[model samples]
Target: MRAIIQQFGPALESIALEHYTPASLSSSQIQLKMRFSTMNPSDLITISGAYRSRISLPFIPGFEGVGIVHQCNEQDSAFSIGDRVLPIGSAGAWQSYRNIDERWCFTVPNQLSDEQAATSYINPMTAWLMLSERLQIQQNMTVLINAANSAIGLMLVRMLNHLGIKPIAIVRRDNTLQEFEGCKLQRIININNRDDYHSLIKMKHHIKVDAILDCIGGGESLMLSSLLKEHGQFINYGLLSAQPIPPQFWLERPDINFSYFHLRQWIHSAEKIDIQNKLNEVMQLVYKGIADTKISARFSLKDIHSALNYIQTNEETKKGKILLTF
Candidate 1:
């Protein structure tokens, strides 16, 4: 079998696609033939040594993927040989085959196809948990989400709409304007890397949102933080701009409730049952086409470098994902 290994340093410096022999599966474990996976921002960030404290040396680097159980000992009633499952928790999905304990994987719903099932975990669960746990948003409350063109951002828009919370989108591309408009989203702020942040930030004068789900932190976060109503929720789940929050940011909006959500932390701390139950709920929403995703391209695992290059070139304009297959 072959796997992408991370031994040290940043991703470009650390990751390598290597062939290896697999150890025999244990009675308590199931051997899986990995089928599909996707490269996410979180995957790049971790491999780039952003979350160094949380990472261990020489580990695989992927959070979500689906696999077919090829060698099952019938230890778990929920899964058996030839079952399609997602190996949840921690990282190690960037491989051709895996020998994982039966308890760590969950059977994928028949409703989702291989492409959809591959992306079923990360974006869906992260958005759901933020709305269901951290934010105290009401149906009529106004919510603003940055990076509204990305996969997770698009999902957030739909999730908020389903909850009846008014969503104001801040996106980076103009091509997505018509797409969001088609959905009847009332407010869409389309800005570019060169535009003045203050000029585009006119939400405060028009309306005060109750909560802001910000993914692009940095100066973008600084300006957006000002638009939140007093004591509103400001949840920062990503740093797409590769910058930190300005030191004086908090002094300006001390009344705003600021918090960070890490799906990895939640996965490690929450009971397995809770994670499974939450994922099932999100899958049902996907089945209803409420939380669907798009795909821009698919690549074999061997062409990982080419895939990364494509992601960088089309990131600002691309509305879909880059998938990897064995």
Candidate 2:
């Protein structure tokens, strides 16, 4: 199998594509013929040695993939030889094949294509958990999302619209406003220009916000918390800016609530049955087009270096996920 290996992390150009044998497929495991893989922001961090998890040298690097089961152990599983599945893992996803535990592999809805299913697990699942589970959003309530041009951001916007709620999209560039032009949105604000008081005016003009979903953490997180209604909730799911939320920001506001979310940790903590059930709910939404997993760009497994570079330089235009297809 051809896999992207991090011999010793530096720039993405340093990642080497090489052949390797997969682990043994036990009675409880299945071999997946991977078709597509998604490039996440965390993938960059993992390769650069800045992420919280430390990976040893000469390791395959990819976390989520969509593929077909070529070989399956007949160990009372829900999967079959020809079933299309999404394999969620911490690494070894950027390859031609992956051997995953049957319990960790999930069957995607028939409506999604191979590419859509490939990018499905991470962003859409996070968006669903942020709104449906973590925040417990209700009808007519308002939510705030930073980096609203992203795939997850777009999905959250659509989900809120479906539930008769509102999403206030906070974007950095004026050009991104066009992406959500036709969609039903609460408001659109340029973060650099909008002040807390000014954003409060905009929030009041559109709708009273009940929650915040922040991916761009740093000073922006503090400002986002200000827009939330008194006693409202705030969930930070990513640190695209690679900075932490200050403790004083939440301490100063006694009425507001703040928390952080990580999908991998949540998955690890949950029972296998529970994780699969939650993933099914997220996939169903994607199948119905209530939420979409748009592929903004595609790259080959061999050209991962250029793919990483594109993600860095074209953050705005690359509004959705950058996928690697086999």
Candidate 3:
């Protein structure tokens, strides 16, 4: 089997494609023939040693992917040979094959294409959980979201529109405004202009936001929090700015409720049946074209370096997800 391994050193220098023998599966495990995986910011962060405490050396870097059941033990009744499934919550998805515990895999729906199933878990699930579980968003309520052009942000917009909730999308660039062309319930606020922050404050009169979904931390997070209704929630999931929020920012906003979301922590706490149900609901939305995965580009495993470079250089204009096809 071929795999992308992070040996030691910087992200670009450490990553290398090599052959390895996959281990035999235990009674509780099943072997997966990887079909496709995604190049997420988290995957790159891990490779760059930013997540050193959680990952050891010489480890494979992908976090999620879609696969076919190449082999399965008889005792594992949940899966069978030739089953199309998603290997969830396990590392080494960047490889051609993986042996994962049966509990970690979920059968993919026939309605979805390999591209959809391949990029399933992270963005969609995160958006669903943030809207349904964390904020408990209700119809007619207004929700504020930063990084509104991101994959997760777009998912949130569609879901909110379906539920009759209004979404205020804050973006850094003017060109991104075109992405929300048909979204009736969406209000695009460009933060690039100094006056847009005041525009948001003015919007508070017409749109009483119940929660603010913030992925861009640092000054942007603090500025977005100011627009939230009194006692409204501020959920932070990513640090795109790579800068920590100053302690004074929190100290200043005593009335606004702030929380952090980590998908792994939520998965660990929720029941498997509940997780499956949520995923199924999102999958149905995906099938209906309500929740869609937009692919900006695709690359082979051998071209991992170029793929990473594309994402790093075109951070602003890259409007969709990047996939790695095996």
Candidate 4:
């Protein structure tokens, strides 16, 4: 088997393709032949030594991937040999083959292509959980999402639109707006807009949102909070800005409440049936073309270094995702 090995912390050059013997499948596990795997900001952060967890060095790096089941144990009969499945929450997906617990693998719907399922889980599930669990939103309610150009952000936009809800997008660059030009968005605002912070607040007051999905922390979190209506929720799911929100801001805004969303936390805490039902709902929407995954680039496992280099250098213009294809 071949895998993207991170012998050192997540430096671009530190990741390399290495050959390893395949492990025997556990009684409750399945051996997967990977076909596609997508990169996330966390992958970059992990390699760069910026991730918070204490990851063991020399471990494989990858979280989401699409593959076919080559071997499975009878402990779970949900899938069969050659069945297309997607690995979620399991790391080391950046490999030719992976042995994953059967519970971590989900049968990919026939409607989704290998490429689409490859990038599933992290982004799509995050988006679904945000809308379904975190916000407790109702149809026709509005929400504001920062970093609207992100893969997860776009998924939220599509899901909200399909539900008859509106999504207001906040982006940093004018070019980012072009990606959602034809999107069924309620509003799109560039943070660099001439509208002062006060004007931005007044604008939000007109069409108040039920919640705010803020990926950009730091001062941006404070700004987004100021726009929230009374009792409206604020979900912080990412920290792309790499800056922490000042304590004073939260103290100053006593009326605004804050909640953090970690996809794993939500999934593990929820009922199994509920999780599967939500995932199925999102998958159905995707099958109907109400949502889609954009593949920005594809690379082989041997070219892992080159792939990381491209992602690190071109983070902004990297529309969709950079995936590793086996």
Candidate 5:
């Protein structure tokens, strides 16, 4: 089996392509031939020692992907050989093949294509959980999403729209605005400059959103708080700037309900049944096209470095995910 191994530290330098014999199936295990895995920010960031405390070394780093079941050891399992599934559990999606427990494997609906199924877990599930569980968002309420053109960001946009809620998209470039051309977004605010606070003020004048979904957590996060209503839900799901939201951010707006959401945390603690059920709901949403993202490009597993470089340099034009095809 061929896999992208992360044995050392700090992204591309320590990571390398390696071939090894496949490990035997353990108890309740199912073997899968991987089809496609996304180059998610979480996957890339983890290699940079972001979650070193919880994640062990010499580990595989992909969090979400799709594959066909090649072997299922359990006779009573819902999955069968030839079933296309998202064999999720541990982070090993970067490999051409993976051995995972049957419980963690989710069968992909026939309605979704292989590429769509590859991205099934992370963004769609997170978006659903946030809107339906974490934030007490209601119909007709307006919400602002920074980095709104991102994969998960787009999910939130479409899901919010489907639920009859207005979405205000905050993107960094004018070309990024093209991502929202077909969507019926309430407003699209392009922050061309670091000092572009006037556009924010104009949006505030029109409507103080009930919640704000912040992905870039630095000066921009603090600036966006002005658009949220008093005691509104201010959820931070990503730190794109690699800068933490300081203590003063809460002190400045004590009434704003600040919260940090990590999908890994929820998956670790939630009941297995609940996880399966929620994933099923997310799949249904994807089937209905309520949660959808464009595939910007794809790369072979050996070209991992090039894929990383592409995502880095093409952020302005990246309306969707760049997959790593196995």
Candidate 6:
């Protein structure tokens, strides 16, 4: 079987394709023939050794993928030879085949294409949990989203619209405003311009920000916190800027509630049945075109270096997710 291995060092230099033999499955495990996986920011971060504590060395690097059941242990009655499933939670998804426990895999909805199902789990689920579960946002309320041009950001905007809530997309560039062309929203703020802050402050008087979905931490987070209505909630999910929320910022925001969310932690804490139910709800929305991912590009496993380069160079301008096909 061919796999992308992260030997050591930076993403491009450390990652390479190599042949390897997959271990025989245990009685509760099933073998998956990988169809497609995505190149998420976390994957690159893991390869760069930033997530060294969670990831062991010399391992296959992908976190999620859609695959067909090629071989299954006879005792594993939950899966069959031809089922299309998402083998999530475990690493080593950037390979031709993977042997995973049957319990960890979920059947993909027929309404979703292979490409859509391949990139499903992480981003959509994160958006769903934040809006529906974590914050429990009600209709007619206004919410602010930082990094609103990202894949997850786009999903959040769509989800907010579906629930009849107002979305305030805060972006860094003027060109990003073009991406939200057809989406209904309260306002789009380009914080790159100093004048925009003055406009934002004035708008806050009429529009009470109920919550803030912040992906970029540091100064940007502090800025968003200031915009929140009294007792408003702020959920920080990503540190795209690689900066932490300063201690002083948290200390001063006594009227605002702040919390952090991580998908892995949520998955680990929830029951399997609960996770599946949430996934079903999100997928149903996706089937209706309410919440969906945009595909930026696709690459074969051999061309992973090119894919990494594209993500690195076009991080700001890329419109959607990047996939890796086996």
Best by TM-score: 6
Estimate candidate 1's alpha-carbon lDDT, on a 0 to 1 scale.
0.79
Write the residue-wise lDDT of candidate 1 on 293-314 in tens digits: 7878888988887777777677
* Over 4 Å off, model 1: 9-13, 173-175, 192-202, 316-318
lDDT of 1 at 308: 71
The 0-to-1 C-alpha lDDT of every candidate, in the order given, reads 0.79, 0.77, 0.80, 0.76, 0.80, 0.83
Ranking by TM-score: 6, 3, 5, 4, 1, 2
lDDT by residue for model 2 (1-326), tens: 56555554565665777767777777888898889988877777777766535677666778888889888865577788889988885687888888878778877888788876887788788888777778876767777788887777888888778778767788776656678855688677776664734765556455657888888888778766666778888888888787888776768666877788999788888887887788888878887886666676888988877887888888543467888888
Stretches of candidate 6 exceeding 4 Å from the true structure: 4-6, 315-317
Least accurate stretch of 10 residues (summed lDDT) in model 6? 1-10
lDDT of 6 by residue, 37-112 (tens): 8888788788877877877767888887799999986564687799899887878789999988887888889989
**TM-scores, in order shown?**
0.90, 0.89, 0.93, 0.90, 0.91, 0.95
Please give the clash total of every predicted structure, in order.
0, 0, 0, 2, 0, 0
Residue-level lDDT tens digits of model 5 in 94-181: 8888888887887677888998788778889989988887889676887888888777788888888778876888887666666665
Per-residue alpha-carbon lDDT of model 4 for 1-326, expressed as tens digits? Answer: 46554565555667766677789977878888998888776777776665436676667788888899888864566888899987776468888878888777777788888887776677778887777676776867778888887777878888888677778888776766567755787777878876734566788657676788888889899877777778788889988788877796578677776888888787777775676777787677667765667777888878877777777787642457788888
- Model 2 steric clash pairs: none
- Candidate number of the best lDDT: 6
lDDT measured at residue 13 in model 5 versus the true structure, 0 to 100: 76
Please provide, for model 3 over 56-169, each residue's C-alpha lDDT reduced to its tens digit, 9 standing for 90 to 100: 767888887899999997564588789998887757888888888887788789999999888778888888887788886665777888888777887888888878876888
Model 3 regions lying over 4 Å from their true place: 6-8, 201-207, 315-317
Q: After superposition, how far is residue 157 of candidate 3 from its true place, in Å?
A: 0.8
Clashes of 4: 2
Candidate 4 residue-wise lDDT at 212 = 89
lDDT of 4: 0.76
